[model samples]
Every structure is written in structure tokens, then in C-alpha cells.
Target: MRATYPRQDPPRGGVRSWWGKAWQRAVEEAAYSEAELKGGRTAARRGEVGGISVDAGALLAAVREGDDAWTVQVDVPVLDASGRRSLVEVVAAESGRVAALLAGELPHDLVEHAEELGVELLPYGGELAATCTCPHYLAPCPHAIAVLVQTGWLVDVDPLVLFAVRGLDREALLSALHARTADLEEPPARVADLVDDLEIAADAVLRARHLLELLESDAEVPDSLL
Candidate 1:
């Protein structure tokens, strides 16, 4: 399915949360001056970023600057195949988590579990890098920074965007989970076996009730039966 990035006000701690702060820090480190960083933040808040496409270890967005359009690209490396498999294993280990993610919810616990599995879903410290077609010479000029900020907002809504930036889209991840769990599932029980098991249980229950009745009546039980 084509991914969606619904417009939204940045979440609480928009620049303070792990993902948000990390992106901000990376952008700050990359920027040449505070003015540029401040301008980028303003653009992001003003919703100048749109047509956001997140995949292939990059985020592509367009910015409208007074009738002129600038293309912005944020490049970050995604996990290798082995790392992706490790994360998939973590998700598959908990079917409920997989179900939640597939249903379009990003659970905090799932992110925690990914961390424990050695998969860092969000970029950290100096990991973010960017380029934009604007006239500014900085690596992540205001346009690029705006795109990055908007991407962080998208990440808040769906952690899978983080994965998508890491080169593993939702469909691919779910397919991996299905493949991993397929062999782990037990075959369905046969009808005959289920019926026989139920019948045996019923007989045992009847015998127990009969013995209880006999004890209550103070009846003498046969020695052979005992």
C-alpha cells in the first residue's frame, strides 16, 4: 500500500522527544548558523513541507517558497538484511505486537522491543543528513530541515516510517513475519480427535460425580472397584 502522511501539528515535545530531538540535534550540528535552524523550524511549523515520500533510506519532500518549489532529500542509511531479519524476528515473537502494527498503530512497547533486539528505529545524535535544491549552501538548508521536521512528525504517527527509511516497508516486514511464523504454527486438530478427547473428559466427570454421590449416601463401596 502507498504510505500516507496526514498533516498534523507536531506531537507533544515535538523537538524534545527522542525522535524529534534527535533529528533537531542532527540538523543543528549540520547547520552553519542558528538563523538557518530557526528559519527551518518556522517552515516546518508553517507546513511548507508536503508530497512527502519516505522510502529507500531517504525522505523526499517538496517545499513551496513564494511560488518557487524546492526539492529536499534526507539521506540516512537503513539496516542491512541481517538487521532487518532480527527486527522481524522480534515482531514475530509477539503476535499481538505484529497485529497492532499491521492495524496502523505504533505501540511504544514495540519500539522498546525493537531496541532490545538491537534495532534502532530512530536516528540518533549525528545520523541525519540532507540536501535541498534551494539557493542556500548549507547541507540541510531551511527547506531540507523543514522536510526533516515534518518527517519526525510522520514518525510519531507511524513508527513504520522509520522502518521505511531503513529500507523495510510495512508490507515487506509483515511478509517476513508471516514467513517466520508459518512453520511455528501447529496444524489444526482433527474432528475425531477433538470429539474423543471431549468424550473422555465427560466420562471422567460423570464417574467423579457418581463417587461423590455414593460417599454422601454412606454406601458401602465394592473392594474390587475401590
Candidate 2:
């Protein structure tokens, strides 16, 4: 799935959003050299990057450096079915986490927890495959890097964009999330606080066996389990 974000007026600061900084860090760390990223940062700060489009496994943008205009694309591997479930499980672990993501804020540590569960919620910049219409031959030319910088802005506005980049669109995430947490919605309110040891043991065994696990949740299963 693809998600398009509108361009915003440039922010005075480099990146102030919670996930935006991490996005910037990933892009900067992936650079071949500081000098390679320097020009891109300058271009981005000057509002040369505009119109970001994100699809499963790819990011595209329009960048202008001086009189030249170029189209830039950066591709990253998207999550398969198992990976998506892993991500959903991680997010569904806490209602507050889902609330935070839907509210457009992603704490960096949330992704760290995801990493521990064998899910890569964010792409490693060094591993990105970038292409640009510019003359530069490097994978992430200045134009491409500039586009990534602008993409950080989009991530700030919608944390779900990260999911989209990893191949889960908004609706898919909601459906999967509901599926993962649906099981927890069962039980009467009076006894809902009790932990389900049997369910926990089963999930642990399934996880140990490399079986597909439902999304992690605490409540009873609701209708429509996937």
C-alpha cells in the first residue's frame, strides 16, 4: 500500500518530533560520510525537498538543488506476513501504545521493544537502496538523502507511516491489531482482571515452536479472530 503526505512549511528546528529524530538518525547514520549527508541536510533545511510518497518498501520525493530538479526514490525491504504479525503483537501488548501511535506519537523505545521481538519497525538506512535522477552515482545521492530528511517530517505527523513503509497500511494495521487483541476482549468485567495462565503457556509454547502467534493482548477474544 502507498501513503501520500502533504508538504508542510519547514520547521525552524531540524527535527523535534519523537520519531522524526530517530528517522533522522537512521538516515544520517546510513550515510557514507558526514560530507555526503551535509549537502542533503542543507538542501532539506532550505525546503528543497517536497511532496513525499511512501509505499511498501519504498519512499519517493521531489528535490530541487539550485536550478536543478530531481526525483529521488529510496527502497527498503517490506515486512512479510510473519513480520507484520510480530509488529502487531508488539504494539498490541499495551493499549496505551496503540493509543500513542494513533495519536501521532511514537516513542523511540517502543521500536526498541519491537526489535527484541524480532521485528524491525524501522529501516536501517545503510541497508537502503536509493535511486535518483541526479547525476550522482551513489545509492543515496544528496537529492535522495534530502528526500529522506523530508520524510522524517511526515513520520512526525503520522507514526503509522512507518508501518506503511514496512508494508502494513492503516486499515491492515487496525484489522490485525483488532484480531490480536480481540481474544482478550472476552470474559465478564468482574473477572477480567485475572491473568490467563493457560493462554500464556500456550502462546509461549507456540512461540518456542516457531508457530504463528496471535497478536499479544490481555483481554478476552472478541468476534472475528484472524
Candidate 3:
């Protein structure tokens, strides 16, 4: 069976929430996948390096907390032209907890590179505000925009991914999933891929029969049908 789409939260205060806007954009631009988002090209200068890596499952787990705010450390790998790797650490903060992190309440180093990557720990109540360190004055330079687009897709699959960048763990996420569906006896089975050619053939036959019926009713063709 196909997975059912989740119900979206109602718009509030005559404005759509950042999360809501992200979701709408994602459905509208459903061209890229999670892997493509994470592994795509970067805008690092010839000798410069920076990259973003996120665990979608873990991030979604953190977002599910709603009232509870948490932080996580993400190691983004930046590479040079020669494939040399350098790590940049980011401290991701969640809604309601952004103030704390912003005020230096969190116990992690918000690396300079992360701040440059236009990383923002958006709160649940506000829009996703970001500032990039790239030379471009845009809130999200092309690189940051690419990352944000990918992040949106991740949230569609698992809302907690919104927090995963902030440092949520996998085991903790699984526990949360268990709690959400604790009463279910077993997990649902996965849907198999459809045979495209077979579906096309069936549709073609159906259309042909309908057309033949219409022609015969109008006395435009013989009753015999193929």
C-alpha cells in the first residue's frame, strides 16, 4: 500500500509558519532526493572547504519534542580540490530553545565556519532566519539555498530531521517512534514498485474499449471490437 500523506497544521495568525512554508515548497518542487541533497556540489572556492551533513531520522526526532528544546553537534566535511577533508562543527538549536543557545546557554562551540554557512537555529514559533558568511549579501547564498532545499525534503520524510542537525541521536529517535505507535502490533509492510509497462498496457486497452463503445453507439463504426 502507498503511504498516506500526513495532515498539515492549520495556518495561524494570517501567516504560514516557516515549517509550513518549507513543506509546501517541498511538495511543489519534488525533484530532488535526500541523497542528492547531501551529496551535491558545493560552492567552496578553489582552495576553500565547507560541507553540510545531516542525519534526517535523528533531526526529526528532536523536532518532535515540540516543547522540549535540545541541541546537537553536526560534523560537516569540507573538502579541497584535491579531496582533502576538513571538519566543521555546528551547534543546531530548536524552537523555544533558540534564545538559550543564542544567549550562550548551550555547552557547545558554535564554530566560525558553521556561522558562515548561514546556519540558524530557528525557533518553532518564527520563520527560518539565517545569515550567511559567504561574500554574497543574500540571506542564503546559492550554497546555503541548496542545503535548505535538501533540508526541506528531509523534513518531509521525517519531521525530526529539523532537529537532527542540532545533534539528536538515532537510538533516541527510534524510541520516540516506538512511543508514537506503541499500540500497533507490528510495523506496516513496504509497498513494492509498480510495473510501469504493464500499467501503460492496461490503460491503453481500457481507453481503446471506451472509444470503441462510443463509436458503435454513434453508428460511426461496426459493433465488432478489437
Clashing pairs in 1: none
The candidate with the higher lDDT, 1 or 2, is 2
Model 3: CA > 4 A from native: 1-21, 24-51, 55-126, 163-170, 176-226
- Candidate 1 TM-score, C-alpha based: 0.69
lDDT of 2 by residue, 2-47 (tens): 7777664455455678678878888987777787699887888778
Between candidates 1 and 2, the TM-score winner: 2
Model 2 residue 205 CA deviation in Å: 40
Question: 1-226, model 1: which lDDT tens digit per residue?
Answer: 3364655454544544455455556667766677777888898888777778877677778887879989888888888888898888776565466545543455667678888878887676356778888888766688887787777766654566777888788778756655654565564344224434544654455466546656766887665335
Off by over 4 Å in 2: 181-226
The regions of model 1 sitting more than 4 angstroms off are: 1-32, 103-109, 188-226
lDDT of 3 by residue, 1-226 (tens): 1111222221123222344354435322432344422322231111111223454212111111223322222222222212111111232222222232222133223323333555433222113333334344433333343344434433433433444444343333333333434444655221101123333544565467556646756746545444
Q: How many residue pairs clash in each candidate at the backbone level?
A: 0, 10, 11
Global lDDT of each candidate: 0.69, 0.72, 0.33
For this target, which candidate reaches the highest lDDT against the unseen true structure? 2
RMSD (CA, Å), candidate 3 to true, equals: 20.6
